[model samples]
Structure formats: C-alpha cells, structure tokens
Target chain A: MTDLYGVVPEPLAFAARDWGDLAELMERSSSDLGGQGVGALAPSVQAAASAFLTAWAGYAGESAAIARGFSSALDALVADATHTDDAIDTHFGGIDARLGPAR
Target chain B: MTVTIEVPASQPTIRRPEGQPGGSDTLAETLYTAASRYEEFADEADQLLAPRGFSGQGQNAYQAAGGKAAGEHRAMATTVERVARAVTAYADTLRDLLREWQELSDRQDVLDDRRTALIADINATTDATEAQIAALRERASALAADYAELVTDHDGLHRRVRANEDLLRQVFESATSLDEALSADGGVPEFAQQAMDRPGAPGSGATPEETRAWWEDLSEAEREAVVSSYPGLVGSADGLPADARDQANRVLLDDDLATLGSKADDGLITPAEQKVLDNARAAQQAMADADSFEDPITGERPGGQLWLYDPSAFDGDGRVAVAVGDLDTADDVAVFTPGITTEMSDVPGYTDQMQNLYESTRYNGDGSSVATMFWLGYNTPEGAIDWDTMTEGRAADGGERLADAVDGLRASRPDDPAHMTAIGHSYGSTTTSYAAADHDLDVDDVALIGSPGAGPADHASDFSVGQEHVYVGRDSRDFVAVLGDEGWIGKGGLGLGTDPSSEDFDATRFESEREDRGSTRLDGDAHSSYLAHDTESLYNLGLIVDGHGDQVNTASQSYDPWYDVPQDPEWDRDPSSGVPGQSQTRDPGQP
Candidate 1:
C-alpha cells in the first residue's frame, strides 16, 4: 500500500529509482570505456547528475501528484543537456539556449 | 503581483520573508533560465568553479537530458553572491570607522578616556571585518565541496568538454578518411568530426600523479612483460617516479585490447572520438603545470616575466649611504622610502637620509642593527603631475606598471620581510599612497613630505594606514601642497582634514607637534621645505621608520637630525619668499 503522505504511485513512484539507476549506468559505462576514449570518463559526470535527479525526484515523491510535473520538467532538461551541440548549432527554433559571454 | 510601500524601520510589526525575494524555485530552474537568457555574460567568476557546459548553453539539450537536474548549478552562484556581499559589508564597516575616527581626532585635547574608547572602536571594527572574512571563507569552502561532487559525477566532463574542441581539429586532419571512409560517399563530414583529428591538439593523457599511481599498481612480472613488449615505453618509464612507472606498466600489461574491441563494437571508437580523448589528456597536462605555483609575485610560469631589477650596484657605490638596520632591537627589517625624481643610480644617496636620522634616534643610537633600505632607484617621470593622469582610467597602465615594479621589489627582498614605510616627497607621496592601495602592500606607513594631492579613496579598506594615518607633511607657505583641484586634494589626496601650514592649525589636538614646518599645518615653502626643518621632521621620521607610534614633544626644542641647532624658523621659509629689502644667503653654518 502506497502511503498517501510519503510514497509515490506507479510510474511516478520509480522516478527517483529510475534516475538513480540511470546515473549508476552512466558511471559504469564511463569506467568501462576509461581507456578507449572519453566515454570512460562519463560515469563520473553522469553520477553527479544522477544523484541530483534522484534527490529532486525524492523531494517531489512526497506528493506524487506533483512528481509528474517535476519529472516531466526534468525529462525535458535531460533531453536538452544531451542535445546541447545540436541545439546550439541549430540557432533558430532551438529550445536550450547557449550560456556564457558573447563573441 | 506588483506592490509598493514605505515602512519605518522602528516598526515592530514589520514582516519579512524567510528566504530571499526570488521564491523557493529549485536551483536548477533558476541557473538554467538565467544562463539561457543571458547566454553571454561569463566573467572570471563563471570559470572559477568547475569548467564546462552551463545549462544556458543549450536549453533543449539540458531540458531533454533533465533540465532541472542540470540547473542545480544555481546553488553555486548563490554561494558566490553571498561571499561577495560579505566583502562589501566589511568595506562599509571600515568606511564608518574612518569617519568616526576622524571626528574624534579633531578635538583640541583628546582625553585619555576618549583615546581609549576610539582604539576600542577600531579594534571592534577590525574584528567585525575579520568575522566577515571568516563567513566568506566558509561559504567558499561549501561551494568548493559542491563543485568537487559535481566534478566526481561528471567524471571526465572536464576532459570531454576540452576533448570536443580537440576532436574538431583531428577531423580536419584526415580529410580523405573522414570524407569517404566514415560517410562512404564523399559527403563532407561535420566540423565537429574534422576538429577531432587535427594534429598538434591536446592528447588523451592522465595527470602525472595518476600516471605515477598506475605504475605503482602493477606487479613486477606484469611490468617486465609490458616492458619487453614496448621498448620505448619502458625507457620512458625509468625517469618517471615509482608510481608513474607502475601506472605505465599497468597500461602496457593490463591486456585492455578486449575493452577497445567492445568500445569499437559500440561505435564509440570513431576517429572523432579518438581525437577528443587525445585532446583531453593534453589539457590535463597543461592544467597540472599551471597549478604548480602559488606565489603571485615570483610565480612566472609559462608567461613572460612581470618585472625585474638588480640592486647589486648600490652596494658597491660608497657614495650611496647603505646601512641595513634591524628595528628597535627587534627582527623587523625596514625599508625607508625617500621621494622625488630619484634615478636608479641615486638609490645609495637616500640611504644616508635614513642613516643620518637613525643616528639621532633614541631607538637607533648606534644605527647599526636596523636594516634600512633607501629606495631611490625607481624611475619617476619628471614633470608637473596631474590627478587625472596619476589615477585610474588612462593612467591605469602606469598604475599597473608601478604595481609590477613594487611587486618585483617585494619578491626580490623576501629574506627581509620587515614592516616598511614609504616616505614620499611631493609627487613621490602620491605614488606611494596610490601604489599601497592598489597592491595591498605590507608597508606600515605612507609618510608624505611636501605632498600635493589626496590619498587613494578606492582602496581605503585594503590599506593598513587606517585611512586617517595616510600621514601628511606641509608648511603654511607651501603653495603646491594646499592647491585644490576637483576636491581630490583636500579629501582624497593628503588624508588630512585641514591645511597643516595654517597659523591656527591645531596639531596638538591629535597629540602631534606644531612647527613652522614639521607640523601637519601647511607652511613655509608650502612646496619645498621638507629637507630644511630637518631635525623635527627627521626625528618624527625616525620614530615612524622605527615602527613606533606617533610621539608628542611639548617643551621648547632646538635641534636637527644631521646637525644640532637652536630652535628657530630661519630655515623654515623658502629663501625666495622674503621681500626685496631682506637678503637671503645659503650660509655655511645654518641649515
């Protein structure tokens, strides 16, 4: 039985666990490829991102209804982070904006 | 949601928000949105923490990946703002202390109780500023911890970001392979791939420390097997430390060919990928070399030298009165700065100025122990000075150049790290005060002689002179010292409240002497008489040089630092100041 006050329900329920698992996968993948290329370095970077996602998801899980809103927003951010180069290069009609000083 | 109101601070019912006005939005949203909108406002601060992609760089990418998670970097930004506010508050506190101190000093007779209270206030203010510094340090430490966690999670994020740049170069190198082999039909490959294959880019390599560890982790049998397999690699491993040798052996013997095959199977071993990996390694090497030095003064690494000077010639020139003295029988070494258009060759002569005064000083009866340096070597521009050209803006180049020179001096004389005093004459005073503020110099006092302008207003908190003790010397007739322009002369220039030369000047109020020349009151040549009224100014000068607090003498005084004399104002006035009927002469006996 999901506790209404503390536990999340169904798909939104595993939001924290899913993010944590993905973060762990990223770290393992990075370590596996440590010598072949920069991929080996990915796990370390992904781990922090994973940890942060997990924490945020856990915070929202207390109120499962709100988890959907936060998780969807997080999913969008992840998509943005992965497609950074393409989003930056596309220039027009891009979602993720480039950060830092102008040329 | 807009509202406006004014509230009295004394009201007890005033409501305040628990947090700042920005609301409890998650850290990620704030950082991401700000970066996305601003896009181009990265200062030195942006790169201060971990170097890599900010969420604003690509909104869609961040959003798709987990925008809120990436946006969490905003917490670090808040930490930085908190630290900055702390420093600003400390500066404001110092400013207040200066205002209060100046008011209390103006009274004709500063009672013992008042002086004691003022000192306590100064101590309290300093303590408060120190507390702010501590708070900033704590915030900075926490931010650093967060950043370290980020670095760990990001794994090779630093290497990868840099690798992307290198991979671009490599892709540009092997055009034939990149154009035909990768795409099959000779369609031009993307610039990103082109960049990866470019030669002369950063290579994939671990840090020396990491390499050392690799060497240490290998077994002897494995190391030998690897050494036999790769001859050149083995020889390179010899000069390396034990740890590096072990790590090198590990890479050679670890039988990592299986992993490489898997990586290739996963399509992760593309030419672009290899190029980026190589680049990351190269960047790591460069970063390691850069962090080796901590001292800003002598820490010239890959860059050009900031400044350099040789003072060996001063020792040989006997004409240069050289005496290295220790202060008050203590170990505190002192450097005495005498001002004016002094050339490098004139450095030795100024040493006599300190030595002569030191001989008469009660602290320096023999003038042997205190190591006093006469810094007349700096090349000062010879011409009438203007405030605009002396300070920031266009004159900032000169200021930077001068700062570099002083830094060079401090670096060269590290052995004698003593409390220093810069005794400036006329324009030299301006330079000394300006340099002190700009550099956060270790000098104890900036004693001005025949000064013309105010001290540096911008660096008051950074200075040790407590803003008010930016000491000034003037005579009533000295026209140049009293000249005012743009309000800088009276307020910022001398750091003195009233003209020291005026007849009504109340020097005794601050427990300081009143002289036709030596007093803070403007008088005499108004421009030139510092070296003439030699004894009084020179004695006070000796006390300051000795690092002693200001001393007041009330009884009739008659003397000279270099020669004994009956107390009189004969030498105080400029010979040219007298009427036509009166005659002036440079007597052989009189100063």
Candidate 2:
C-alpha cells in the first residue's frame, strides 16, 4: 500500500524571499521615520515618511484587491463566465508581475 | 475291545450341509470317535509299561507301573471332555452367523422399497411438467389470437381517423371562410345579394374563397342569420383535427393495452407480468413521491425528524434535507455517496442505482430489515482548483454530521443489531474516505466507484471494520481513470488511482464486462456506469452488499455456473488477477 499522507512540495525559496522583502521594507520605513522629533524633523525626512506610508498603503490595498479579485475570477471561471481571463490577468497573474520586481 | 469293534463297523460318514447346523452334529460324532480311540491307545501304552505283574517284581517298580496306568486313564477322560466342548462352541458360532445374515436381508428389503417409491415420484414429476408445458402452449396461442384482434382493431381506428381528417379539414375551411367574410361590415341587402351570387359559399359548399366572397356580399341581417344557423358546424370544424387525432390515438393505444392485459390475465405470463407491473407501479410511486419533498411552502413531509446530516455542514431544519427510504426500520443500513457535485436532488435517482445491491441483501425480499440512504448531506464544492481542497469545510462538516447521525441511530436503536455499508461514487468516495478516516464509525463495508483521488490512509483503524477492506470498482472504459497516475496532479480528477481498481492498489476488484471499445466487453461511457453492468460490477456489488466476500470472485478470478471455472483464454490474466494498470506505475506511497 502506498503512503496515504503525502504532501505536495512547496517552493520554500520563493516564500522566504517574499517574507524577506516585506521585512526589509518594514525596517527601512520604521528607521527613516523613527529618529526625528515631530516638530524638528526635516521636510525631506517628513516627506520620506509620507512617501513610505503612501507606498505601503497602496501596496497593502493592491494586495487585498488582488486576493479578492482572484477569488471572484476563480468563481467566474467555475461558473463559465466570459470575463474569466481578464479577471485572472488583473488579479493573480498581474500581481506577481507588478509586485515581485518592486519587492 | 468293544469300542474297537464299534469303530470297525465303518461308522456312517457324518456329512454337514454348507449352511446348516449339521456341522455341529458332525463335529460331535467325530469327537466321540476320537475320544474312544484315545482311550484305547492309552490302555495299550499302560500295559506295555506295566507288563501285567511287574508291580509284584519289585516294590519301586510295582509303584511306578501303577502310577503310569492311573495317569493314562485320567488323560483319556480329559480328552473326551475337551472334544465335547469344541462341538458346543461350533454350534454357537453357526447360530450367530445366521442371525446376522437375516438382519442384513431386512435392511436390503427396505432400501429396495424406497428405491421403487423414488422412481414413481420421478415419473409423477415428469407428468406434471408435461401438463404445465401444454398449458403454456395454449396460453401462447390465446395471446397470439388476442394480438391479432388488437392489430385489426388498431387498423380500423386508423381508418376512421383518416376519414375524420377529411371532414375536419372541410369544416375548418368552411368556418374560416365564413369568419373572413364576417370581417367586413356590409351594406346589408346589397352585400347579401352579391355574397349569394358568388359560388362556393359555406352553405353552397364551394371553394372557401368563393364562399367568403358570397358571404361578403351578404346584408348584416343575412350574415347574422348565416352565423346563427351554422354555429355548431363552425365549432366542430375548428376543433376537428386535434379532437379527432386525440380520440383516435387514445382508442388505438387503449386497444393494444387491453390486449396485453388480457394476455397477462390468461395465465400465459401472469406471474411475471404481475411482477413487472408491480415494479413499474413502485417506480412510478417512488418517482411521484420523490419530487414531493415537502412543498417548502407547506412543510408537509411526514415524520418530521432529522434522519440525515453532514457533520461539518449546515442542516436544513424546516426544509427537506433528504428523501429517505427503508432507514426508519431497525435493520441493515446502506449509505450511498455520489462523487463530484452531489446534492439532495441526487437522492431521488439513487434508489435505482442500488437496485442490484438492495436485491442481493439478506433482508431484500422481506423489506423490513434492509434500509438504504443516499447521503447527499455533504456540501462538496461545485468546482475545485485543487481536488483535495475543493470542499474543505464542507467535507469536514459532512464527516462530523455523519458521525452524529451514526451515534444518534445507535443510541435510539440500541437493542437492534445494525450493520452499515457505505458506498461512494466518484468524488463522493473521497468524501466518504475522509469521513471514515476522521471519525470512528460502525461501517461494515466501504465501496468506492469511479474514484480518482486518495482513499483512507491516515486512519489505519478505519478499514478494520468487518474484516473486509474497502472495495473498489472501476471499468476500463471509465474516461476518468485515463488520467495518468500521479495521484491527480494540479487539478484533481475523479480520485481514480487510489482505488482498489488500480493494479497495485490491492483490494478486491470487480472488472466489468460492459465494453466501451473494440470487440471487448465494456461500456465505453465514462465514470457514469460503474454499477451498471449485470454480470461483472453489479454482480460483485450484490455480493458485497450481502456480505459474501468469501464467495466473490474478484477481478482476477472467474466463475462459471456450468463449469468449475471459466475457460475463456483471458480468464487467468483478466484484471482480477492483480495485474497493475498498463500505463501507470505502482506507487505504494499514495493511498
């Protein structure tokens, strides 16, 4: 009899890289914003913090949107909806292409 | 001297018959002669040793001579006594042999009598069979006559329908023309004159166009008069073709039905037809009652109770969750799981699918101790990205729900012995395998049909129920099985390779003779027909349901009613022989 509890292999390297990228971004954003007092902080430092916040917010929003979009796309594909390809491209397919390089 | 003299007379020869007591008499005579001869011999020897007056010659010699003479006399007496006892013993032996022979003869007589009676019984049976055959012939003749009458009646009805068609067409033409004529509002008297002058009017019985023209020329009062006069004819014409066809077809069909009914009534095939009719009636009733799952509006399903549930899923409280049959009884329970996209609607047709299994069950004909349930309470995903994770929560919930149902049944029917058989088809098999693995169940048999993914591997103890391992049925024609065996990579197909039908999977295999290709015996249709074949899959399934594992011949084995084993050249190498799939490798690592 074959072993019943076999698990499919996952890409550990890819997963580690994703976590590493997110961790580096979090660290850099925190350090750039943490050192200055609220009133004394230079305009550039303040601007950098704002830019980091905006970028983080946009990335988070896009990540969430992509997950939801992929789910809807999968549902449509199951239901044989015509918009399946577009949904897949904009969500799951487009996500790695848009975010992987940036990360 | 006197004994010697008597012997000299040449005693009449003593003779004994082969089986008479004379043998004892002969022995007695012989013993008497022998005794006398021995006495004479001893007396002569004594004289030789003693020499008449030797005792007087010397004191010691005289004593020795007296002692020898006295010993001779005693020896002679003992010999005579021994011969007499021998004669008596011979007589007893003869008597016992005679008694034994008589007893055997008596037993032989009784056996002969029984043999005679058996011959007579066989003759009687032959006579009865001949009479039955004659009656059957008569009934067949009657059926032929009735069929001929029905055909003639059908022909006559068709002729009437044809004739009616012409009349109906004529009426339709007349009425349609009249209606067209009435379409125009007329200058009463002038129109009436012009309509009357035209030929082929409805009353004139001419062409419909001419009839319309004549009616159009009629005055208003004249048109009304014409309409009123022919209202009945107009109505008849309008309804003619449909009414006539319906009437004719009904008449002919009824005639044929009557002939068939009479054939059944005449005892030609009364019993068989009655059985078929009963089955048809039951099927009809089941079909009718099936759709009647409590009008969601009325909540009218009887015996409002939770008979079925999926542990990890939602249960319909007020609505009908399942259509149940035979489950209310305290007997054997069979739960059927339909793979891939099974819902409550699948329950209705499931009864037909399991007819063979149900028929072979021990309590089949009795209908009291056998119960079957189509367990569609699980919420399996309609589609899946990965086969295993498709109905993740739904499958877990179903397992839990089934556990609860089993528990509840056991508690309520504690006194009655319950045996449960679980049958899964397609994806349903996976769900069942999961349920059994996750929970401790009282299931006796688990059968998977058209399975694609893994089976029960985690719970080593799950299949230990009832000593029989899970049974798997797969046909070569099943297209789902064609998915090469990597245990369904990427998108999971029907869990085909994990089942017993796989060459290395090692379970009892029931290979179907229903061919789907070439000259081979297998129905080509995919995963749909695992239990459909008669001799192969269906027969083995029935055996499983009846718990007759030892009697079953798995895919590699062959059974022939007339011979000890099937003689087909492929019999030995057939799929039942544990031959692994031709295209797939045996991977013991996967379930």
Candidate 3:
C-alpha cells in the first residue's frame, strides 16, 4: 500500500492532451484546405464538401468534450486516493502512539 | 501528437478498442481475495496475541514487564488487523467503482458510434440531413445525462467508503482507550461514571438494544457498582436487560425492607410512616407465603420472586409486585393488574390468585415454565363501590407506570423473550387499556376481566394490540360492568369508555360464567368471582397465558343484550295512584 502511494497514473491525462492537440490540428488543416483547393469545386460539390467538414468538426468537438470529462474524473480519483492515504497515515500514527513503539 | 487526416467523401469508419483491461469480474475477484486474506490475518493475529496479553500467575517485576510488553504487542497487532480490514473494504469500493466506470465507458462508446452514424447520414442526404442532425443531438444529450448519473453514483460510493473508514478508526480508538483505562488502577469506576454521564443516560431515550450492548461491555464489578449505586436508574430504565433490572430492583427491595423494618422495630414513627412500614412488612410476608404456597394443580411448590416493591410509592398507598415463578427465565409470563381498592395489604390475596394462575398455566402449558405476577403497582381507588372512583384519571397515571414496568420486563429478558400477557382485573382493565392505547405498552396479549370499559377506547380495536389479541371476560350478572356504560345521572355517565365485553367493542369474549358449584353459589358472587378455583374464567385465562388462544372457550352468549334496556316503568308511576286508586274505592263493601 505504501509503495503505491503518490503514484497517479497519467494514461487518461496523456490521452486527453493528445486528443485536444489532434482536434486543433484538424481544424487548422481544414481551414487551410478550404482556403485553397476546395475553393475551386462546383457549387453543389462545394456545398456537399462543406457539409462533410461541418460533420467532422462536430465529431471532433464531441471527442474533445469526452476527453476533458475523462481528465477531470482522473483528477478527482487522484485527489480521493491522496486523501485516503493521508487518513491511513494519521490512523497508523495514532495506533503507534497507543501501542507504544512497534517491536 | 498531430495527425494530417483526410475527410471521407461519404462517412469515416468508426474505431473500436481491441481489448479492455481490468474487467469488472477480474477487479471484483481480486478485491474479494484481498478482503478474505485480511480477515484471515485478523483472526490469526487475535489467536496469537490475545492469550499473550493475559499475565501469567506471577506478580514479580520481570513478569510485570513481560505482561506490559505482551499487552502492547496485542494492541499493535489488533490495530494493524483492523486497519488492514478497512483497507480491504476501501479496495472493494474501488473495485465496484472500476466496474461501474467500465460499463459507463462502454455505453459512451455505443452512444458515440450512433452519433457518428447520424452525423454521416446528415451529410449524405440534404432532404434528411435536419432529422439526422436532430437524432445525433439526442444521442449526445443522452450520453451527457448518462455521464452525470455515473458521476453521481461514483460520488455516493466514495462517500460510503470514507464513512466506513472513519467508523473503523473510531472503533479502534475506543478499544485503545478502553485498554488504557483498564490498565490504570481504580480506573473502572471512573470509566463507568463517564459512560453513565454520556449523552444518553439510562432512562433518556436510549433503546433497549443500546442499553444491552452497554451493559454487556461492562466488567462484573462495574456492573455491580452501577446496580448498587443507581438501582432506581438501572431498575426502571427502558433499555436495560430484564435480568439486570431484576437484579437491581431486588437489591433495592431488600435494602428498602431492611431499613423500613429497622425503623419500625425502633418503635418511634408517625402514623403515615407506620402505614408504609406495615405495607412493606405485608409485602415481605406475601413473598414468604408465596414460597410456601403449594400449587393445587401442579402439586409443586414453585415459590415466588419479587420483581418490584416500593413501600413509599403513591404517598404511602404503596406499590408491590410478586411473581409466582422466576420471570427472567420463564417461557411464558402473565402480569395481572388488580383494579379498585388494591393496596400493599392485599398482596396475600393477589399473590394467591397469581399462584393459582401460575399453576394452572404451567399445568396447561405441557411442560413449559410459566410465571404469573400480581402487580399492585398503583394506588387503586379508595372505595370499591363508588361511581366516582371509576374515573379515567387514576387509570391514566397507573397506565404510564404499567407501561414502564412492561418496558423493564422487556429489558430484563432481551434474549429468549417471554411470551408476555397483561391481565387487567376490573379497574385494572381500564388502567391496562389506557397503557395499551396511550402509552403503546409492549405486551403480546391483553385480557380485561370484569371490566366496566377500556379507558379511552370505545372498541378493543382502538387499543394498540387490536381486537384480535384483546380478551374480555365479564359475568352476565356482574353489576360493576354496567357502571362503565351508565353515565352519572346528573353529572353524565361514567367516562371509562365502552365496556370491553359488549358486542360493539368486538373483543374475543372468554367464559367468565359463575354458576353454583355444589354448596358454593359461585355464580351469585359477581365481579370478583372470575378467579375462583375450577371456574371456566380461570381455565380460559390459563389457556391464554400459555399462548393457547385456540383452546380458550369463548362465550357464545352476549352480555350486552340484557344490559341495554330502558328505565323500569314502575319507577315512573304517579305517587298518588296507589293500586290505581282501588277503582274509586267501591269494591266489596259498597256491593
């Protein structure tokens, strides 16, 4: 138990940070593409392309929201574990005082 | 990590996780195994360390040091084991949370996939795009709602685990404190005093279970001290076990009798004091007589035990209770309350009735032990025949006391509780009914014999035990039974409520028939003949006290039919019309 203390696993944090970075990159890439080659398409085809981009943006936004939620949950879990560890330490200290020096 | 991605012309393929780590089954099984291991360690530690804490038969310095060392080790081991158990529980909670989180994540994935498909369909067709987008929005909203519920559930589990850990810590601390106190010389008394002075005192809203637990935790010497010093507190407290109350009350009774008897023997006392002393002596004599009194039915002398006695109670009217057998261990017990005109002086007669009922019940019980108590624990009315004496005021006061007595009995016998019944005779019935109605008295069955009415209740169903367990017995010719219904002519009727034996009251009517038996005109003897030997009333009462409800002979005939009638017409006739004026006085002489 003592060995596991203060070890907050960063897998969820890493995933959330990576997902946010990817979403930003995607938005930049889409903006650049819209400014260049996609500008030359027929009106109907351009309209369809714009609709697909909008759908992709929505999916990216939702993914970013989910990643944030997971990051917050992980933070809360770490806080809980820290509190439990402190409580266990205080309890053990009191027990030591009552029982005198451990053999 | 940044990626250059290509937008699909139609729809992007949805990705699913190849494998999920730490499934619910694996996590739960691991937690269970840890918990089991901790429990096993606790058991083993207790076995190893508990015996060491006990000092061997030597009081030398070396032995003392060894004992102190052992005690410390024991305490440390116990604390470690308890902490381990708490950790196990916390781990189990975490396991549960992990399982729930996994399920929630799976649900979120499914919802995400649905939203993605809906969004793709929206981009595919212009006509259906609005509906598809709306469907996608609904799925997203559902996912948010599910996430909120999952968070709430997780928070609740977290709170529970924290609360459990706090409780474990508190228990461990309490045990340590108790051990330290025990090690100190003359600390037990101080500890007991502190416990007694704690938030919930003996009679102040502490439940019987709480009282029993507190009592069990005390050492024998501490228990004795509490009983001796605070007999009244222990004796009358609602939650204390019955045996403890009995012990405390018996100690008080003996001390009281000795003091009162010594005062009387000194030969200098007021009339009032004399009466109290006399009542105390009478109670003692009754107890002694009960010891010698042979059971006519069983032919075995079961003797008696005094559960309660207060000579100075009721402003010298005195209160006394004598059980014909050991009530603490009895399988079945009945507490009979005597009504009007009962006093400590009547203990002999009451105890005789109790003894008879006890024997009858024991004989009918098929080897089951039965204890019957003659509880004269109130100042009954001074006059037996006065209508004013039948008021509900006395019954109400007596009812509260009766309720306490029942609670005391319940406390005394927490384990293997007796099947208890309350038998109230005459005004006692009114008192018992008041107890049943107003005080919520804890009794299994209630029998109202020769009762005028049940106080405050027009029907037996109005009582706490309901009509099913309410037994009524009244001889048809008993004149006292009518007084409950007949209001005071000018002041209004007796307000004791409805007669329990009346059909409208709807109680189980048992036989109280008092017919002639040989030379005895038992039937002619009304009101008090219900307890006569060999009477049907006593037989049925015995059956009820023994919990043989089906065997009780219920009265087939109704007593109310004959009692409910108009005033006689003869009393309303004109005073001047003697024999109808002799038909104008002509008869034989004029002819």
Error of 3 at B72 (Å): 47
**B40-159: candidate 2 lDDT, tens digit per residue:** 333333433433211233425533643553354335323332322222322333343445445444544444454454444444444355565555445444444544444454444334
Task: Put down candidate 3 lDDT per residue, B1-591, tens digits, no spaces.
Answer: 222212222211222221122231232222222222222222322332222211234214323433443344334333322222322322333344456556656655665675567556545645445565566556556656655565565555445434433332332233233343123221123444566765445765777566766777765545544554455677666566545555555545544443334334433245776787688678778878777866544567766776676777878888778888777788888999998888888898888788768756755565788889998877788776565465567888889889878887887677778888999998899999989989988888999898867888877778777778989776666666655552223114553677676666778877665544222223456678677555667777888898886667676424333445522111222211112111111112221
Supply candidate 2's per-residue lDDT for B558. 17
Docking class of 1: incorrect
CAPRI accuracy category, model 3: incorrect
The deviation in Å at residue A42 for candidate 2 is: 94
Instruction: Return the candidate ranking by DockQ, descending.
Output: 1, 3, 2
Ranking by TM-score: 3, 2, 1
Each candidate's B-chain TM-score, in sequence, is 0.32, 0.38, 0.58
lDDT per residue (tens digit) for residues B195-313 in model 1: 22333111224333333344445443333323322322432321223222222322221111222223334333445334333332322232233223221222232211101122222
Q: Whole-model lDDT for model 1 versus the true structure? A: 0.34
Better of 1 and 2 by TM-score: 2
